[model samples]
Target: MAGTYSVNTNLIAKLAELRITEKDIHACKLPAYEQSGNLVQAEDDMFGRTQLMTPATLTSWQNLKKAAQDEGITLLLVSAFRSIDYQCELIAAKLERGQKLSDILSVNAIPGFSEHHTGRALDINTPDCEPLSEAFEETPAFTWLEANASRYEFGLSFPRDNEFGISYEPWHWACRLLD
Candidate 1:
């Protein structure tokens, strides 16, 4: 071996990119996420795997799944709890790909401001529905969630033109403990 070489340009690049102006940071206005209860990895379902979530949320989710199954609606998981670091990396990749920060923010949440950070939010879909699309609202699973998820203390995070700048995500549900 000749000489060992070490480099960390990637880290440097990340830090440099994060050196955003006050206006830019203000424009982002990341969401505030709250955490409660112990987060545990969700039990695998028919659709796919899940990330870690609160045990209470998990129990409600399991119950929701059972009810959906009983009604012949097998809900699928598109996403669950995601760490802030992961969100940062995801946004960074999008930014690197020449996507506008506003455009990216319209869809994905900024690291510290994601509902997924609370281990309470989850994205769901059906095997027959398009993932993360409005079409999901037309699916039986969405309909089931709409009709019954409330019983499990789950509710949709967004509806078309609700308030937050983020786009409507019909598949995104959260189990917020009303305190």
Candidate 2:
């Protein structure tokens, strides 16, 4: 199945051309967020918000979801693979509503810097939790993830006060499938 997933040539070229490091990848700068690739929606046998992930990412996520379910924790996907274009449109829509880009950037990641562009980040919530909010941390699903997500190679991509300066999002999780 891994063969079905090819590396994002554009992202590699962008990274190579820009010489971005790990720290740069997390930066809010425009150069850091430039990426493009093919995507596939994965909803078969899954629930909640439909997700788009690299085929391999979807496989790993399925494994992780099963683990959560075995523990009686049903995680709901709130968001997933988002194209840089879509993200930009979202920001544009916000701007149209009179929201400042700086304020939007504080909450929503600036395009390419968003993990959702990589098709590996997941915004998970429980039936009782609020999606994309810190209140999710109080849910049993969050507790289960905190204790066991890493076992599936999934980890919280950002925590409170993370260097990226984005707001705390307890529902966000990422699969570092590449490394």
Candidate 3:
């Protein structure tokens, strides 16, 4: 046989076009009702933890939850749908916690680039546990996700090989095109 041929660039180009667009993305902002009716009441959950999400995201979470339950794995929603100000506060707190500004920028997405800004993204936890870690990712929660998340229209937003600007976040998951 002659030399093997590589994949065609034209085919790759066609495939790329099918990918989701920025416009289809939705950022976590003040909820509609909160924006117009209860600005003062728009508060972050105690200690900056919250699990609010857009309808699309909630649906995805429901699916994920159901699948996890079917397999006897319990996954808890730790944080979701953060507002711009809430993000700012989080950044400031991290800064106060002795993290260098540059270091913060490296792993954490700037306000705009934050998938947390998109109501579709979530940071999950186990019962009474804190922020997620590799230990958790290798546990029942992550295993359950690996087995069923795609079926529920959720995907690991940042993996080791992610092209996204952010670092790999084992706990973060994004819902199908936040459109």
Candidate 4:
């Protein structure tokens, strides 16, 4: 993926504040994502938080959700479009709770490196599953996504033993831009 945003001094400083070094960033296989400047309000998530995404992503998400609904599956949005600052805050909070940075980094991408910064990634859940849990893979929604999400240009970001070294997140999907 091409990054439209550069790692400026501010982002570098933020990463440093969170104890992330240039070596650490380079070591991660995930690419840095630029925050989308043309995001539109997609919808309210399960927790009533306003979610935003690129217009193309929003259209694909709606179409994907409708297709799933037509097949008696329900996909609920848990998260979308997290900012670099928000990612930093999440990591800082975990650190404050005494979690090891290495442990936290496995799950949460370091600041600007998160796919969420691109406004194309989503965390989805179904009514029957716990939000953000690996148990989501057991749901019919997951099976349906595995079978059909590609038709709508969405794909699971991290499956078992993904190249990025991130944990397997069954609920995290990203809408890929067509070339």
Error of 1 at 148 (Å): 1.0
Model 4, residue 162: what's the lDDT?
Answer: 91
* lDDT tens readout by residue for model 4, 25-111: 777778777877778898899999999988899999999999999999999999999988899999999999999999999778889
Ranking by TM-score: 4, 1, 2, 3
Candidate 2 Cα errors over 4 Å, as ranges: 1-38, 44-49
- Comparing 1 with 2 on lDDT, the higher-scoring candidate is 1
- TM-score to native of every candidate shown: 0.79, 0.76, 0.65, 0.91
Superior by TM-score: candidate 1 or candidate 2:
1
Question: How would you encode candidate 1's per-residue C-alpha lDDT over 23-134 as one tens digit per residue?
Answer: 4434543345544346788866445565778888888888998889988888877778887667778888888999987677677754555788788888887887778889
The model with the greater TM-score, 1 or 4, is 4
lDDT of each: 0.72, 0.69, 0.58, 0.90
The list of candidate 4 runs beyond 4 A from truth reads 1-6
Query: How many clashes in each candidate?
Result: 1, 1, 1, 0
Given candidate 4, what's the lDDT at residue 121? 93
| Number of the top TM-score candidate | 4
Candidate 2 residues 6-28, lDDT tens each? Answer: 33556545444334333434444
lDDT of 4: 0.90
**Which has the better lDDT: candidate 1, or candidate 3?**
1
